[model samples]
Target: MNRRVSELGERGLIRRLREKFPSLHSIGDDCAVLPGIRCPVVTTDSFFEGTHFHRWWAPPQILGRRLLEAALSDIAAMGATAKWFFTALSVDPGIGVNWIEGFYQGLTEREDVILAGGETVRGERLGITLTVIGEGEDRDTILRRSSLHPGDNLWITGLLGRALDAPAKLEKAGGLSGKDLKPRSGFLSSAELEQLRAFLQPRAELELGIKLRKAGIRCAIDISDGLFSEASHLSLESSVDTVLEIDETLFFDSVKDNPLAASAAGEDYVLLFGAPVGLEFSSVGCSKIGRAETGNGEMTIFLDGERVSINAKGYDHLGVRK
Candidate 1:
C-alpha cells in the first residue's frame, strides 16, 4: 500500500527525511551551518513549472530571476550577504534555446551575485533549483527564527498580496495567450505593469535585514509562504503565542482592500521580524502587527478592535487545494 505524503505534512515529511539521513546538526533551520570561517550560511530553493509557476504568467527570464531571488530571500532572513549561487535546471527538450539563454542572462545580471556551478537535465516539465551561499557580517549577529522571545513585537516589510494579484491582472488585461504572457511594458497600463512586475520579479529584502541585524534585532523570517503561516512558524519555533493586531487603514492602503488576501498571499519574499522596539528603514515600509507571548504556539488576529477569523494557512507542497 502506498502512503500519502500529505498525511505526513511538511514538518512530518521533513522529520522523516531527516531520520532517514541523519546529520550532525538539526535540519529544521533555514540554512545549513558549516562551522568555522565566518558563519557561512547556505540555503536552497526549488521552483516547478506547473505547481509553483507557469510560462503564461512570466517570461523565461523573469522566471529565472524570481527563482534566484527566492533563494536569496533565505540568506536575507539570516542577515547575510549573498556571495554565490549554484543552479540545477530540468528542462523539456521542446523549450526554446533563446528562453534558456534569457533565463541565464536574467539570473546573472545581479551586480554582486556570481554563478558558481550548476547542472542541467532533461525532464517532462521545467524545474529550477538554486543553492545560495552567504556570509554574515558578524558571526555572533546571525539571526534565526528560533531566537524570537516573548513580548517581542512582530513587524513586516513591504506590501503584501501584490504577487497574488498578478494572475488576475494578467487575465483582466487579456488572458494568458502567447502575446499576453510576454507582455510589453508599453502595452500595459502603469498599474497593470506594476502588479505584473511585483509578481514576476520580486526583490529580496537583504539590505533591510542587514540593517536590522546591525541594529541588534535578532528574530526574523522571510515571507515566502503567507504571513500567517510564517508568523505561526516563528511562534512555534520560539515556543510562544502570537497576537496579530493589524491596522486596517495602513494594511488597506498597502494591499488595497483585501486584508485576508494579504495574510494568505505567498511569494511576497519580504522580511518579517520580531523586535522589542520598532526600527525604521528608508525607502521600505515596516509595520508593527503584533507581539509574542508565552504560550503553546497559539496565534490570533484582530482587525479594528474586533476579533477576526483568519485562516493561518499558506502554500504547502502536500496540502490539499481549495
Candidate 2:
C-alpha cells in the first residue's frame, strides 16, 4: 500500500526523510551546516509555475528575481551573508529563449550575489530551484528559531499582507482572467502597481538580520509562510506560546481593513525575530507586536483588544489540494 504524503504533511514528511538520511550536523534547523566551512548556512527553495506562481501575475524577469529572493530570505533569517547561489531550471521547450535570457538577467542583477553554477533542462512545466550558500560573521552570532526564550519580544520588519493584495488588484484589472496575462503598461492604477511591485520583487531583509545579530539578538525566522505559521514554528521549536497583538497601522493601508490579512498572508519574506526589550534598531522600521511566553506551543492573535478568528492557513505544498 502506498502512503499519502498529505497524511504526513510537509514538516512531518521532512522529519521522516531526515530519519532515513540523518545529517551529521543539525537536521531541523533552517540551514544545513558543513563542519569545515566558516559556519556556512545553506538552504534550497523551489518555485513552480502552476503551483507557486502564475506567469500572468509577473513577467519572467520579476519571477526570476522573486525566486532568488525567496531562497535568500532563508539565509537572512539565519543572520548570514549570502555568498553564492546555484539554480536548477526546468522549463517547457515552448518558452522563448529571450524569456530565459531575461530571467538570467534579473537573477544576476544583484551585484553581491554570485551565481556560481546552475543546470537547465527541458520539462513539461516551468520550475526553478535555488540553493543559496551564506556564511555568518561569527558562528556564535547566527540566529536560530529554536533559540527563542520566554519573555523575548517578537519584532517584525517591514509591512505584512502586501503580497496578498496583488492578485486581487490584477483580478480587478481583468489581467488575471484576460487572454493576455502579461501586464500592459499604464493599465494598472498606482495602488495596483504598488501591490504588483511588492508581490513580484520582494526583497530579502538581509541587512536587518545582520544588524539584529550584531546587536546580540539571536532568535529569528523569515516570514515566507505568513506570520502566524512561522510564529507557530518558533513557538513549537522553543516550547513556548506566542501572543501577537495585531496593529492595524502596521499593515499597508490597502490591507489594513482586513484583520486577518497580516496574520495569514504568505510570501512577505520579512524577518520576524525575538529580541531583548529596549534594543534599538536605527532607521529600521520594526514593531514589537508580541512576546514569547513559557507554555504549551500556542499562537494567539489579537486585534483591537479582541481575538479575531482566522481560517486561512499558510501555504503547504503537500497539504494544499489542487
Candidate 3:
C-alpha cells in the first residue's frame, strides 16, 4: 500500500502530476499552445481551500469550475479565446477519488479543457493552481495597466456586490453546480444566494472585447480586483484621476444601500474598459460610471464627488483573512 501521500514535498507533488502528461511544449515560456492558432497569450492563477473559496460554502464541482474560470478570465481580459490549460493540485488526507472526480466533472461542464498535467498529495490543506493558454493577434490581445490614455471614459460590465453579499441567491439561481447545499461561510442570505446564482459563473467576454477592439476601443482592464482598485491602477498607469457615479439601478437590486461596496468588491468577473467617450459596443451593456482626467498626484477614486479609499482586497491567497 502506498503509505499516505503526506510525505511528498511540493516538488514531489508536482512531479507526480507532471508525469501523467506527455511533454508537448517547453515551460520556459509564460504559456504553451498547440497548432490551433498563432500568437498565444498565456495567464495563470491559483485557488486554495481557505484562500480562494471556502470548502463549506461550495461543492467540489463549483470549486473546480471556478478554478478554470479564474484563469480563463485573465486570458479573456487580453481579448483572447482560451485554447487549453494546465493544472496542479495539493490536498490532504480528507480528499478521496470521488472528490477529485467531481472536481473534473465541474471543470468539463464549464468548457472542453484539456489537462496538460497535474498531481495529488497528502497535506494539511487543499489547493489548486491553473495556467491557461490562448491565441490572438496584436490588436485583439488588449492593453495592460500601462496602456490607458488620457481623456478616456471608464466603463464597467454586469452587476456588482451580487457575488460576495448573496451566495444563497446564486445557489437558487443555479449559479453553483452539483448538489445544492447551504453556504459554509455564512456571508450570504437566502435571497442573496438566489441572486448570486443568477450572477456569478465562469464567463468569457472575448467575443465582445474583440468587437470593441475592432471599433477602436483601446484602454481596458478586467474587474478582477474590486472596480475601485482596478480603476486606481488605470488612473495611476495613465496618469489621470477618475470620477465614479453610483448607478443605483445597475447594482444587484437587493443591495442598494452601499452600491459602491459591491462595485468595489471583487470576484464579479466583469471587464472594465477605458475608451474615448461615446464609442458604441455590442453584446454586453456597459455603464459609463466615470471619466479620466490628467493629474500629477496618486490616483484617486471619487463616489458622488467624495473621495473613497479601497485596497486591492479581492480574494488574496496568502492575504485574505479567514
Candidate 4:
C-alpha cells in the first residue's frame, strides 16, 4: 500500500463507483473542449479585490497580464490555441481611466488573441472576469485529466515551486501603494524583484502543451492550485492511484528546504502531465515526478521509498481551505 491520502475520503468513495463503471472516465479538465469543426474550447475565469488579488499587489498593466495568462493556462492544459476573449470589469469610483487603459493595453498585447467585446460597470470593489475561447490544435490528442491511466509516468514542465514563496516575499514588503512599484523598504533586492515578477508575469505554455500532445501525452493539469492539490484532482478524475516523488531539485531554490510545503504554495502555472514510460523529456525541460498506479483515486508522496503524508492546501475563494 502507498501512503495515506490527506483529506480526501470523498474521492476514495467516488473512485469505487468510477471503477465499477469503467465508462464514467470521460469527464474533462480545465477548458471545455466541445466537439466541432476544430473542437472549440472555452473557459471562464474571474478575479476580484481582496479575494483573488489586491490592487496594491502589482501595477494595472502587470495585473492584467497576470490574470489573462492565468485564464489562458486552462487553454494550454487542453493543448488548445486561444483565438478570442471577452472581458467584464466591475470597478469602484476611486479607480482612474488611465489605469483601465493600461490594463487594456496589457490584455491586448498579444496579436493572436482578439478582444471580441467587454462590459464595464461601477461597483464597490474592483473585479474582472474573462471568457476565453480557443480551438484545439489537434482534436484527437487534446489533453484531459481524465485521460490518465494506471502505470503512466508523471512529468512536470519547469520547476514545481518556481514562485512558491513569492507571496510571503512580496507581502513582506507590504506591497506597493496601489499606484506604483515603490517598496516600503526603500529598495528591494534584485532576487526579490525577480521573484515578484515571476508571480506577476507568468505565461501560459501553449507551445509546451502542443508539444506534449503531439508527443502522445494526453493527460495534464495546470498548477493554479498547489501541485499536490492538482495532482490529487488528476488522480481522482482519472480514477487511479498516484505516487509522487519529491526531489529536492524539483523545487525552486527559495523553497527547496521544505519542498512538501512549497509544492502547495500554488501560482506556478506550469504543466503537470502523464506520459508513457521510457520517454525522456529532460532536453525539453521536463522531469518525471511520479507515476499513476491501479487503486482507488488516491495520491501519495514517497521520499526514498518511504511514504509521507502532505497537507497540500489549495487556494479557496471563500474562508474554507481545501
What are the runs in model 3 whose C-alpha is more than 4 Å off? 1-33, 139-141, 166-191, 198-202, 297-322
- What residue pairs clash in candidate 2, if any at all? none
Tens digit of lDDT per residue, candidate 4, span 210-278? 888888889999998978899999999999999998778887666667677778878788999998888
Q: List model 3 lDDT by residue over 1-322, tens digit each.
A: 3433444444554454344334412253445545666777888788887667755445667667767776777776676667777766677765554465556656656445566444454557888778777776674446566556667776776666655554444444443434654443335555565555544454656666666566666667777777777877777777777666556765766676666667766776767777786674435687777777777425554555455555555322232222
For model 2 the TM-score comes to 0.80
Better of 2 and 3 by lDDT: 2
Task: After the best TM-score superposition of candidate 3, give how far the Cα of residue 48 lies from its true spot, in angstroms.
Answer: 1.0
lDDT of model 1 at position 101: 59
lDDT (tens digit, per residue) of candidate 1 on 199-277: 6778998888898898898899998888888998999998899998765443424355566666777788988899885
**Which of candidates 1 and 3 reaches a greater lDDT?**
1
Clashing pairs in 1: none
Model 2 gets an lDDT of 0.74
Models ranked on lDDT: 4, 2, 1, 3
Q: Which runs in model 1 stand beyond 4 Å of their true positions?
A: 1-37, 174-192, 248-255, 278-284, 311-322
Model 1 TM:
0.78
Q: Rate the local accuracy (lDDT) of all candidates.
A: 0.72, 0.74, 0.62, 0.75
Q: lDDT score of model 1? A: 0.72
